[model samples]
Each structure stands twice: as C-alpha cells, then as structure tokens.
Target: MRCQPERGHLVYIWTKNNQFCALCDEPSGVERDLCGPCEDELPWLHDQCSICALPLLVDGMACGECLQRPPAFTRVETPWRYDFPLDALVTRFKHQGKWPLGRLLADGLARHLLHAYGEGLPRPDCLLPVPLAKRRLRQRGFNQATLLARWLGAQLQLPVDEQLLRRTLETPPQQDLDAATRQRNLRKAFALSHQVELRGRHVALVDDVLTTGATTQSLARLLRKAGAARVDVYCLARTAKPGD
Candidate 1:
C-alpha cells in the first residue's frame, strides 16, 4: 500500500516549516500548508489504555496482561493505531523502501512522548533504538527503529546513541507467534553495549510499532540492568483494542 494521503499534513505539522511534500515536492495547504481535514484528523495519543497505549479507555488501570506481567519499559506512548492507513504507512517505509516515512513517524511519536510522560518522565540523555539483527538489517538495507530514533532525537533535542545497545541473538519474525512465543523469541535477543556507560542516565528506546511489546520489554530490561536509571519507549503506532 502507498503512504496514506494525509501523511504530508502530519509531516508539515511536526516540521512546522513550510516544506513541500517530500513525495511530490508540491505545495501543500495554505498557512501551515495543511488542509483542514488532514489537520483535524491527525490523531494524537489521548485518554487511552494505560498498558498497551490503545485508545478505548481512560482513567482505568493497567490492562489484564500488564497486571499479570508488566512490560519492562517505565512507560510507553504512541500517537496512532496500528490499523488503517497508518499500517500502510509502516509498510511503505519498511518493505517498500520509503525511508522518508521515518521522519513522519518520529514527529507523531515525539508529541505523544511529551504528552504521556510529561513531567513525570525522565529526560533521556540518549536514545537507544531496539536493534535489528545483521541479516535483517542487510535485507532491509536499514533499521527502521534506528531511523525513528534518529529523527525523534532530532525533534526532541535528545542524543541518539546508536551503539548503546547490541543484539546478541536473532530470531524469526514474531508476527506469527502468540504472546508467550513472542516473549520467548526476544529473550536475550538484546545486549547492552559495554562500549558506552548508560548507568544513571535516562534512556529512550524507539521502535516502529509495539505489537506484544516483547522486544521492547526485553530491551528495557537490559537497559535497566546496564546502569540506565530509567527507560522509556517511543513508538510510532500501537495496536488498538489490544486483546484482538
């Protein structure tokens, strides 16, 4: 699928400069160069599920899954749902080799991070992207999570440390797995880099989408072990109605 038609407006809002659409370089809507519908429809992460960051409820406690077993990240935020045109946006970036979408995704994520974490969240000194395996990176020609981290870091004015985390294990895709299987696959998949000292410093982990959150959980657990005082996740989109 192509990138969503409204994606240009979202980018305009985040960049806040009069930038021609990257895909077409055509002039966008007037003023901020955004049409009314696109601007209105830009979904911000609002009163939502506390655990999965979905959009069904607010003022409620954690979801059942988090109660049974919570994720390792201190908190999470996502501006859009992993459905509809947003899903298409992800595919365009990852599989279709449309790298510009990373900047668009990062813009949404930065706003949500500030909204959800607010003052309660620690200001991270560095951004640690959930690393990808060598083979996967070679096939994709890029790590989408790392791309998001870089762009998010620029927007948030945080440092993006590409070497803060390392991948010790590589497993098959988690898309076909259940929650338990997903967790098992990612276990020990992430290893903190001794080359950098993360201890006592807050770190933000970034990724494209959080499915079961197993990968993020595993990475966060490791970051905490490696002297990171606090860990948070910044993802572009999260699944809606997580139970499915």
Candidate 2:
C-alpha cells in the first residue's frame, strides 16, 4: 500500500533563472531551486561502492556484498544519501505529486551527471526509467522514474526510451521486503519491450531512489542478456545499509 505524504511538503514551481530554495525557501541565487547552503547540507555520498554507490567509510572500495556478487549494471551515479530533508523532499514529490520538488532534485542530479561526464564518466546512449507496475502507476498517477528520465534527457541532450523496458509483474512494495525477498519478488518482474534495438548501445536506468538495489540489478541483468553494451543507474539518492 502507498504511504501518505508528509505534512511538511512544500509546493513550488520551476522557473528558468530565478527560484526560491525548496528546503529553506530563501532566494536560491542560482538556476535551481536549492540554495548553496542547503545543497551543501544535503547528504552527499562521498566514499561508496564504485558499482552500487552504497555509502562507505572510505573511498575506492567495494561493499562486501558487491565484492561477492557483482551487479549487472556498470555503475551507479547519485547525488545524495537517503536521509533527513532529502527523504522528506522525495516523499513529497513521489507521494504527494509535488513535481516541482522532483524537478529540483532532477536538476541537481543532472548537474551531478554533468560533472561526472566532465571527469571522464562515460555517457550512455539513452536513458531508461525503471518502470512501475500498472496498478501502482494508476494509484500514484505518475511514474517518478519516467519524469526524472525525461527531465534529465532534456538537460543532458540524451534520448529517453520510455518503451524500451517495462514492468511485467506487480510485486509488493520493495521497501516492505527484506533484501533477499526484494530480489525474489523481482524475478520475471521486468522484461524488454524490444521497441528499440539496444544492441551495442549503453543505457542508463533512471529512478528516484535506490534501496536494496534488487530492482536495478534485475533490470540490468535483463539488459545485459539482451546484448546491451553497458547499463548504468542514475538516481537522486542512495540509502545506507538497512539499520545503518
């Protein structure tokens, strides 16, 4: 079942050159809706697993799980850790349909990806959003992943293939399941639409957040088996290990 939006949800609209900070509501002093200080205070992921982007104590190290079982995706790029005001912001956007907040975060993610590309990160040929189940899509009235992908595509000048991949199963909410159960729940949950040829092309999966990673892992494995040259994940934030 879906959760209700928090009482602290903020309502704002996007502007081209001027906007108020979504967090503090002060003049952002930038193109985006987040002020410099609030952006700095965000739970930025510094040192993390190179592949999964799981937060870590040191840099350039893989988490124990990834070392044992590597994910099919090449790497994950995210801007913040799932905590505090970020959690609230994401909840508002996803649950309450506050698209402007989603836009704010998507813009931040686009900037992050731009910096990464500047630092030699390989850009994918297209962006694919992690599809939501039909039932859930109706309930929520939108797919956050699709919105992020479109926004990022516009910002980065990449094509977004919304029909390239799809969710074929309606599983329980992943947040309610354990890691192992999450993986099990996703079995055969996704399949390629084959509307576009992905052969030899690199693609990035867009989503609002990555938790146990089972969803992306499942989708990545499918893409790899279908002859995709590479797969990557781009999201607004990565959650710490359960109970961390």
Task: Output the worst ten-in-a-row residue range by lDDT, candidate 2.
Answer: 8-17
Clashing pairs in 2: none
Report the C-alpha lDDT of model 2 over 1-244, residue by residue, as the tens digit: 7465556663443454577899998989988778999988998889999889999988778899899998999899998999998999999999999999999899889999999999999999999999999999999999999999999999999999898788998998878788899999999999988655778989999999999999999999999988898999999999998677
TM-score of each: 0.80, 0.90
Clash count, one per candidate: 2, 0
lDDT scores for all predictions? Answer: 0.74, 0.92
* lDDT tens readout by residue for model 1, 1-244: 8675575466444565554543344665543333445534555556666766756666446776777877677777677777765676688888888876666667667776776557465677888888889999999899998888888888788888888688888799887687789888887788767656766887878888887778888888887777778787778887755464
All predictions: root-mean-square deviation over Cα? 8.1, 8.4
Which one wins on TM-score? 2
Q: For model 1, where is the 10-residue window of minimal lDDT?
A: 30-39
